[model samples]
Target: MSINDHRLVQCNEKDEETLLIFKKGINDSYNGKISTWSTKKDCCAWEGVSCDNITGRVTELDLKQHFLEGEMNMSILKLEFLSYLDLSFNEFDVIRIPSIQDNITHTSNLLYLDLSFNSYVSSLSLAWLSAHSSLKYLNLSGIDLHKETNLLQAVNTLPSLLELHLSECNLNNFITNPFMEYLNLSSLLTLDLSKNNFSSQLPNQFFNQTKDLTYLDLSWNNIHGSIPHSWKNMKYLDYINLWSNKLSGEALVHLSGWKQLRIMNLGENEFSGTIPINMSQILKVVILRANQFEGNIPTQIFNLSYLFHLDLADNKLSGSIPKSVYNLTQMIKFTMNDRTMAVVELFTKGQEYEVQQIETNRQTIDLSANYLSGEVPSELFHLVQLQTLNLSRNNLIGTIPKIIGGMKNLESLDLSNNKLCGEIPQSMSLLNFLEYLNISYNNFNGKIPTGTQLQSFNASSYIGNPKLCGAPLENCNIKEQNPKTPTTSMKNEDGDSIRESLYLGMGVGFAAGFWGICGSLFLIRKWRHAYFRFVDGVGDKLNVTLMVKLNRFH
Candidate 1:
């Protein structure tokens, strides 16, 4: 058949009608390009609608992130042959899932169902989901499932389920004991229950059943207590996020056997004790910040060449940073999530830009708010891709290395609250991309560097460094106000000497003039008589002039 003939083939009339009705149910304000679902065009060519090649029946209706509004019409149920249905990230205004009886009317062959990111939808029950036996990938995240008391029980029924994402779905009532007998979901690979209210110790029986699970995210929930040792059997597990929870104990020590593990986040929890020493080599991102993990960082962690982000901040961790840190050339950000100090993201439109935009290759190192004491490691300067370097609030001493300028990508640098002395490196002027700098409360002295980027900063950047001077600080070469000093005293003495010499010269000149005139008068008697006659005539003229002026005035 010619390509044009294939293109002309029309979609099933029933499927077209169903899709047209579905389009009508949506609000006109919806931003998605579903307007092309007109009868004039082939339904197979319509946006968000895909047809089966053989049957010409609609099988996929993907309208993800469309900003769509209004309720979902039951007309979609007419497409019983549909296998992939994705309405994720759309603005469905609190439309609840249809009841089991209504859903059962049309036995859908749905294999992938995604209604994630629809926050308004409240309540999910086993009855609504049990009708779909062929479902494998089910994502109902951001839905309110607080009242769904039999949540786990319903999930247990989906024998063919492979991936389940129930994140942010108020699963507060779901709790099971470690020994509780649960139906095994051996085929499941991904399970996400993060940002929920699952307040209870992790049930070992649950993870024990899903041994084939590769990705698990229980972060930002109320899952408390230690992770049970039984989870060690899930050897295939790769990614796990247990951050922002009340999970405690040395549970991480048990997860060493999971060789496939890569990303692990246990930050903002109560996990005490040293970081697990027997971590897998394939690990990439490890964040255990805001915990009480004491003792030195495990040297083995740095050997993970693929490791990108390592955040052990806000812990009681002591000892110097391991020398192996320099080996992490690919390390993008390494922090110890401490208070006030941070690895900042320099986004243009505030924090929102960070979420919407693609991530840039930013390298950072934050060892702030620790008892780590020693010379600032020279190896740090070699990480040329570094953007943020924060070593604030430590017992670090010695001068900042001049080679810091080699990190041309540096956007933020903070070395505040340390015992670092010596002059601020003039080489720092080479960092044209530097946007934020805080070297406050250090023993740094001498003139501040003069670069447009450096001078543009405020006085706070150099505050508490009483000896530091220049723009953004006081000028170092300003003259003192002391007039009694040796320089001023010498100036005063010179002035006195000049005054005495002037007096002496004037007296000599006066005497010489007087003696010359007297001697002249003594030698010549006629001269003395003439001088007296001249004086007498001048006095007579002065008297006559005064009298004439006085008479005129009268």
Candidate 2:
């Protein structure tokens, strides 16, 4: 239980008693996450507790998602050596954040603190955090901070802070002026202020100073107006999400300078004008749906080989789908690295889905609700690794090519409300992985191809097509007309030959009888005369018989 000359034991006796006291206050009856905190055992060996090897003092306490309920006990704060503490996702009904006026000497060594998602803990004041200058990461997400004033000015005191997450914290009151006259967070890399009540224009000066930011999320706010030109100063930004805001204008042209940007989401905004063609070449995901953007979709968008997800739905884009879509070879084969994983919210099969972690082979292309026309490019099926393909509610025409069967990995497919005609490709039956399908409201005809997967969907999938029929729909009922066999042909030929023979025999017999009678009359005069006499004698005998009968009657 000792190390290094036995000067320091496994855990200090005072820290062990403090941890036991901390456990007593928590109602761990549900999960019993801290059951090992016993007097007989070393406190450092307990779950979610880590101690300094040489100092024998608890330095890290992680109790996230432990299902422990009760008011937070301040006894754990006595461990002055603690540098990391997490109480996120617990059932704590009330938590009084330590104020600078209180005895916060124990938090002097704190480097990281997370109290996020303890929903019942409503009010928050970050005045005490200003004293913890050594703190590098702080997350108070899902905690209400509406009452706090001068919040940014208070956080500016932490010179070492790198990542700050205040999402869903109700910090709308202080966000109006998120910066001070002298900005101090030059080293900050990630900042998330999403799902707040920011009803004002975007802070113009704030972006000018946060040049070191690599990740910025201000989504789900009431922020209006164009993105400030100062945003171009954030050259290091790799991910930026301003989704579900009231932001408008063609100001995205300012992003031409962001060479390091990898994921950009400006969806569900009031943005108008054509999509920018000067997008970063290395961007992996771009979501610009539900905007007023019009004009042909830039072919340059397909030039991005690394792009696996592109959502341009609910726009006014016209013209044919660019055949250059086949250039997205990376989406067909590339294996994404762990650093490239992103969370994306996409609309597929009439529902919105949030994919927590995008996988390497999971690709999507949504061009629905656009003005796009002409045949669907066969090149689109080249992305065999695609998972969702939605081209619905467009002016698209022509048949779905048989090559679509190559996309066997498809899980959701929607081509509804288009002018597409012809039979649903028989090759589509090979797509055994299809889970959601909508081909309704098209000019499609003929029986639906047979397959367990195709038939599994409801009749609605085939609705709006009067000519389409089969299992999921009503039966076609029409039987096939096959070609005649050799046997049937030979039987008809034999019957014709028999009738010809009978007619020939009858004609030959009549000719022979007539010739025989004529030849006898010409060659033999006696026979000819006898034949005439026999006929006359018969006539005379008949006449004599008639005369005798008349005489008898008289």
Candidate 3:
């Protein structure tokens, strides 16, 4: 032990000695935070240290996101009374996880341990965790665990564990039998195995033991095959995320009985077939984007009163958007990407980014790049909470809803690449929050709306609409024509008016060209003299030609 360790151990009280050792370890490790830890002050009041009321012993040490660096010395293991330890979100890149296998058995009372976001941790470091029989919550997210082959086996040793998060751990394979054993533990409720390289399909009996599972995330893994019907056994499940996988076959039917399910995300998969009409009524979110599901959306889906998020984009689903969707006042997110399923993104600070979930009440609807036809239903505007709307790359026709302004919260709108005709809705000017607007490649005529928000959009928003004109585009009508000339007005009242406008535009163009040359000559003395000389030569030649013709005739 060093001089500092000796001083820490010199505390008169046993509890004080334990805390002093812990404090010394923290101070010696890094300096980003925990400056409040000093022997002059009560250890109980030190930052991130919590003491038991009756025993006056430190029970918890939470230094999460403190930017702490350097090696984690074993001095912390001296806290025999410590029950919780969180050193998450710190810069421990230079420190390998201390081999605690020899010492953890002495500190078996620890119930919670979170070392998440410490990138230097390795797979072997986790073996010591199994020694703590009392451990309930373990989060090792963002750790390098590629070499740990018996992850499930190690976790199974902690029967008291309730929530295990190993996300972003570089986990490649798992022992299915051990995982099943871990799942069988009645205490386990949440498990996150996301962002791994698990390429194998899930065992058919994987969920057989997950009776108490409430939250399960297997997203961003290389797992393949159809979803097992056995998952229906987990009646207590509330959240299931299998996003960005190779899951195929018609798996929605197996989930129909998940009455307790709240959020179900099977997006970015290979599942095909129509969405089940008889899904769980209690579902709050349903994301099935980027699949091959075809046919009309089931009307029963709109009846899900509790459903808020429905992402069926990037699929082959056909038919018009159901108007009954207006009933979902709880709707916060809805998407159907017009491009490929994977290209949907959110814009923030003028930057494009993807979101795993929506945390706000901003309503969104995207039905772009589909075969749906017909005019956009006016009832859609009835969703007063509506925010973003996209109906681009479809076969829909007819003018936009005149009362779209009713959606007071509208922000982004994309109506590009369709056969929509007629003037844009003037009520669109009422969209105060509108930030992005794209109505290009449509048959729309007349002037683009001139709202501050509307005019802020780039000219690309109105491109391909030849007849549409305004700022962001050419002016609706240029008034530079000569007053005496019969010019055409670009008014759409009648066919005759359109013809006259065309003729008038041509005449104005001709007069402007003629005067442009004449004015240039008059403005410059040299050019004026050159112009006169050329004109006189031409006149003399013309007169000589006329005289010659007359003489020949005589």
Please report the candidate that would top TM-score against the real structure. Answer: 2
- Candidate 2 lDDT over residue span 83-154, tens digit each: 999999988877644444545554478889998998778876667676578889999899888887768877
Higher-ranked by lDDT: 1 or 2:
2
Pairs in steric clash, model 1: 313-336, 313-337
Candidate 3, residues 1-554: lDDT per residue as tens digits?
11222123232366566556544444334553466666786666666777666666667888888777665554465577888899888766543344535364464678888888876645445565566778899898898877776666777788888888888988776624445644455677888888887898888666666777688889888889887777868888878888888989988877767788877878788999878778888876677867778888777776776665566766787777676645564552344322211212343322345765544354556666667777777766776666667777888888887888776678778888989999888888888888878889999988777688788888988899988888888876654222223333323346687788999999999999999998899789999999899999999999999999999999
Per-model TM-score on C-alpha atoms: 0.77, 0.82, 0.77
By summed lDDT, which 10 consecutive residues of candidate 1 come out lowest?
349-358
Model 2: number of clashes?
A: 0
Measured with C-alpha atoms, the lDDT of residue 225 in candidate 1 is: 87
lDDT of 1 by residue, 1-554 (tens): 11222554568898888788778768746555876568887888777777777777778888888788887664475587889989998877745444545454677698998988865666545466666777899998998878766666677778899999888887765555222377668889888888787888888777778888788878778878898888879889877778779998986776678888877777778988877668888876676767888888777876776665566666787777676555674643444332211122222211211121112255445566767777887877877767667777878889988998888878888888989999888899999998888899999888887888889889988899988888977766644222278888899899999999999999999999999999998899899999999999999999999999999999
Scored by lDDT, model 2 comes in at 0.82
Residue pairs in collision within model 3:
313-336, 487-504, 488-501, 488-504
What are the Cα lDDT values of the candidates?
A: 0.75, 0.82, 0.72
Of 1 and 3, the candidate ahead on lDDT is: 1
**Clashing residue pairs found in predicted model 2:** none
